[model samples]
Target: MFSAAAALLAGAAAQPAGAEEETGSGHAVVRPVSGVSPLPADCGEPPIDGYVLNPNAEVLPTVATDPNRPWHLVTVYQQDRWNRYGSNGAVTAVSDDYGKTWRQSDNLPPFSRCNGGTAANGGDYEVTTDNWVTITPSGAAIAASLSLSRTGETTAILVSRSGDGGRTWDAPATLARDDNAQFFNDRPVVTADPYHPGVVYAVWDRVDATDAGWTQPVYLAKSTDDGRTWTTSKVYDFPDNSGVIGTQLVPLADGTLLIGMHHETDTTAATQVIRSTDGGATWSQPTLNVPAPFAVGVRIPDPDNSGDPIRNASLPLLAARPGTGVVSAVWQSQAADGTFHIDYAQSKDAGLTWSSPVRIDKTPVGSAAVPVVAASPNGTVAVTYYDFRNNTADPATLPTDVWAVTCKSNCTQPASWREQHIEGPFDARKVPLTSAGRLVGDYSGLVSVGRSAFTAVYGVATGDSANPVDIHSAIFTG
Candidate 1:
């Protein structure tokens, strides 16, 4: 069920007792499950009514949780069965028992007209991608996604908010709409203000602003009334029509906000951080912390990678340390051996500077991609990723398994972290192909539920035709 590369990774490593590996920090335990748990069937199915089904994939899932009410969690993603460019529609899942159980609902807030009709039915492009969700201190849960018209001609950013603990959402709000059909919006992120309950910020990359080429112009939208009204404008513009991606937002404790993204210009790639003092109204020049370009994509040797393209490539994720301005960022990096692994760095002074990057994944062979990091209230840093290391058969077809690492504190040192096996070995081959390639997802979701426990949501193959790709939730209590 795996591609050629994944089977090879599993074959390279031996499955020690319980798949546990002893690291410098602690014992890394690979907990076994009876295959992946099923997500709500109603929520996992896409509404691909009229369009011809391509390699319909349920990918790019993200999650948000209530800090005050750890039991309340929400996740949103795309159900793209028709085409890779457009999803059937955006789907939402809600969990009230701290991710133990989930329910699917398309009761999204009402949407505005984009090109022809409502944003959902805008054009032939008919897909939604890169959706994100956040819960404010006031219990208002908000979500954002990028909508493209038929044939992927035009793009727009849409938003929905819920005031009743994510049970019911208000009308959808249009944060940013492309004036020119040639322009595109990618990977919009939503973040709630840490200091203010009603304040929220949404940021995304807009391409082709000045010239015909795609330029990376970061746009910001602020909602002061908990998603009632909005002000949208460009916050930072890169020199030339240079390219950038991976938009990340984090609201600091002192009323300021920090945005992180990967900036690519010419032949070089680097990590960039820009800050705003007065909300999202203005920003400073991006500070280049890491000099190396984010790895393009990993090669999973055995499977015919020709058709399977990684959904979201070379995107950086950020997590703020508890009780301090220090923040840690993780992204996929190609090692000297030509294998992809997770890399980490931290900025102690509120995104001003970063430490040297260090590799986190312990797999000696194969590739690891799509990493997400989260910091607990007690300063425990947890990182989750999927790798092919567990598929040990000689001509391995077993799929990728989810792995995690945790550090009590001072996680910057690679030796201080302990790796743990979460779940996997499902048939990655069962996941259908998209225009972007075989899609497990662009990214997975991880959130700190309590002081020591963490809840994660990720996509895995169910080996069934009804739903080729399914999203499952797991909890890590170490």
Candidate 2:
């Protein structure tokens, strides 16, 4: 029954305009522009002047562009350098000139026990992180994030909407709130319903402090009146409290939603999902793939610090074609020689079945991590990721680059893709580390604009006197 539902939804989504054949011959070209960060010099945070915003880190940028106005783009992200449980707030950036430049805004929504902020807008609760933004066909923008109160005793899922192209926003409405004294809420994502304008969806996993220990339950919510109000449902209950990360929600043209997430246990990691056909009202049983050998480790150049690795591991990334049910997924895996590389697979029949996994990145010398994939209106599939391939310096200092590949046509064919450089050659060490000790946040973003274009935003260490990690945007065309 689930397979039938997936196939039906896949068929409902419109396929790309042309045949599934190669179109261009050259490489996937990305033009760089002078984009701006969402936060100002002081990030609107009064007390801290040049001290924080000047050399601070803005990471995990998620973008949403207007369908009619291709040049109008809206993005949201977390503020402050990596502070683990304590983050400044959420900030927004708007671009009207095809991403040539950006304007900052304090449009983040608020949550329980806290009145929304303005003088220094951003952040939900007193400490917030894991922000996501998306746009409706009417060009309205919606933002969501996980936030905690000043005392960190409560956590809530907060959302806000921007009708004026992100220049201004409405007060946030809360979807879920809990004491959070023993549980934690993290990594929540939002998606706009393409078929039904003004309707949007949000999903995240909830950890509960059960008497046995802990258990993870997935939750879903929907807002039909453009985020003014919301209704939430408990989607599924995992057998154990395994950690779920890198969750991607894909809304089909037929009103069905597909969720792709990486579920991790103590010994192994796997890609899993729970589908909702009636706007997240109910969900099918969780479908999981075979477990892959996985371990978290960071490579350091200093021999003395080599054994002490940071929290790092491969998490699944997913993308779905605009009109078609064709979906592509990628993650990182280590080969026999101990080299980490990016792997790819696709599902022609929605999430029912996927092709055999194929290694996609060029010969891996250093390592490739945090892969993000997106599909163009022309049926072109693009994958963006960070790698140390160009790092000639000591591995401890970690110099990396942002690279992308285009599958002109037959994306399922491993050899049908061409590689192109987007941005980078910056020192990763300069970027602040999360409580997890990982740089560049857990994931970045890559979004397709129109028939022939796409955009990606990532964090890069400027290595200037301040040594801050700033946000950079690149527009790519074949």
Candidate 3:
């Protein structure tokens, strides 16, 4: 089933084009894009309710475009998501026409049974999560995910390479793995070096238990020869009772690697960054970027589902401006009224010194969640997030909308940013309900297409039980 569906969706065949509309913010156009890779009915093992669960759902998309070829875009997302956990596997979709169309890839290294995983191939995990993709300077595309067993016995970080655009992928290379439940790995993010052609990096958190308490060490894997093989090491480890997650690598043009992470202790939480000047050999102590007021890590109470909470997070997203040392970060922060707002901050000296955080979400009445940031070559910084401003009072339905804000100059100024509607007013309540809550995704994808444009890939609800959520793409131009 997986092979057949992959073959069907693997080419230049176009998915339905969404309506085109112009935004009031003077943006050129807002074009919605959809993928053709819907999960098959039988996507292999770990069946749910006597059949594959959420067969038509796709979520947690990550998009990257080639620098040499801007029109060549690739997005990796989870397909056939389960209610409580991960999807059947991670899949890739390639768009050569600047996201006007896409080709879905079926060869993702078989991280789960749905994609042909087996115990002998080191991909026998029951599910796969945290799908991330990056394009190296040499035009090689790399996809990474956290594959784990159903019984929590094994967790591994695996990456696959696409020498072509993203049309096909090679078998995965395991960067790091843990067979014991005591040491679990989570939230793996892969990054390709913008300055080096064949150098790639993968970072994640390894949660370990000890006599003192729980500790999470940030692990780094370097593949100098593209994504063929990797050397893993512990770059930074939090103290006892403290751990870090959502680690993202921001490689600068000057050979410095900056890792942005969400650090949490028993009583405190903050967003921090660790720098590696001489590659991944050693990392400096973390420098605090922003302090999280609330410990709200990912899951929030769903107004519609009392038993389930929305899988949202305030995870910091850091992006470096192309050909510049300036880096910007964005994350959602909870307010006194229990509503979440998008916050923005910038670092001029490569994550060493950060400006004060500023609220960026324009909608005053509702909460915002899952913010993603990107910086263009022309020094324009943009962010995309979902908000509940359009939601009604009805408990049975939660109307949500996607929005994007672009800053041309000083992003630190609240008035310098202009907000534009990307897509939405779709009922989030109609999406698949998971144990974590209504499923959208932990994060979305926003990548700069050129000097004044960006392509955002996000998840939306379809209101159909057979296909509740879909991965969507939108092109925004200034």
Candidate 4:
């Protein structure tokens, strides 16, 4: 017999068709994808950070679409958050008819007990974090995550493949694992090569601790046979006490690869990039792209929280125009007055040189977090993020909204951009409160659907503890 949670999850496979809510300017249409069902209470692990499980919350979503079949869309997210670190397990939702409806899949390779994990299957971890999904040119869907024990006993990177458009999944293949106390892996990203048929790359940071301090080095694992197997290598390492995190891989149309990361020292943090010409064989030394004014991995505090804050970061999002070699990056940076703003920079010559960073968020007040960027075939760039500009003087409630900005050409100039309100003005304080803070997610999803329209999959709060957060999608035209 299936558990009550499992039975409910099975019944939630086919979500109802969402009603179209067009923006006032008719530039975008928003749809509800995941519906209002509460997530399953699947993980039996005890909470470590004094916070109870928030089973109604769903956070940290990543999305992708099959190029050969534009109607095939896949989104992976963390469900039933603990308000501290990870989730009960990750959930995969597939939409074959564009964004109209979705089918939630239960085959995610069991990263925890919630997903039928066991020590025999190498999924004995207590919780999972950082869910990412991508579709290859041949319609194969790949999902990746950071699976680890809550007590810091083990940490690993795992990838799973789906051959039938995400209706089901095969057992996940472990890409890298660390059993000792000295190494911890975090912030993994998986990308299928757009030009190469069966090649996919996963990049992350493995942090090592010594008597001096902590040092994190970038690691790369390449799978040439569509994630069946992987060959791992250490691509870059910093000196002791210095490291990097949030590594992102962007494969150009001409077969060149660019990896962008947040390089950090004890007192400084900067956005940096590295290039690989002959695939993953060798890489150039890192080049400093933008020196950040604030720390990279620090979580933002909730304005309404008197005790615990919300868990959010300012990780950089990178994108490259198909054939023009024009690469753009967007991230949240804190100003001198302690306000966070979304910033954008461009690189015309691949990942070598970058233009000066410009403020992209049009909000004159409040802070922004979790910026995501995507590029269309015609070189148009779009960036999406959430801001607190709608919040009033009420400390009991925090009103938040999602906004998107797009630019066609001359993107370096501040005036060349157009801003549109995608969704929200919801109560941000209604999310799960964790040791890290109240949680929406560390990142959201935004991808180009065609030449001008982009689809974003993101989370929002509903002010109801019984159903706190829900995943929504917005398709907007530049």
| Model 2 per-residue lDDT tens digits across residues 350-403 | 566778788787635766667778887777888887777665536566667888
**Considering only N, C-alpha and C atoms within 3 Å, which residue pairs clash in candidate 3?**
298-312
TM-score to true structure, per model: 0.83, 0.83, 0.90, 0.91
Worst 10-residue lDDT window for candidate 1 reads: 15-24
Poorest lDDT segment (10 consecutive residues) of candidate 3 = 15-24
Tens digits of per-residue lDDT for model 1 on 137-224?
8777898878765455667887878775455666567777775666888888998875777888898988765554557888889888
Which of the predicted structures, 2 or 4, would earn the higher lDDT when compared with the native? 4
Residue 205 displacement in candidate 3 (angstroms): 0.3
Q: What is the lDDT of candidate 4?
A: 0.77
Scored against the true structure, residue 440 in model 4 reaches a CA lDDT of 62
Q: Cα RMSD (Å) per model? A: 9.3, 8.1, 4.4, 4.6
Which tens-of-lDDT digit does each residue in 398-442 have in candidate 4?
Answer: 888999999999999989999989887998778877665667667
Query: Distance from true position, residue 205, model 1, in Å?
Result: 0.3
Global fold similarity of model 4 (TM-score): 0.91
Residue pairs with clashing backbones, model 2: 13-323, 14-323, 89-123, 90-123, 301-396
Candidate 3 lDDT over residue span 41-77, tens digit each: 5654656462335676788889998877666678988
Model 3 Cα shift for residue 121 (angstroms): 3.5
Clashes of each: 19, 5, 1, 4
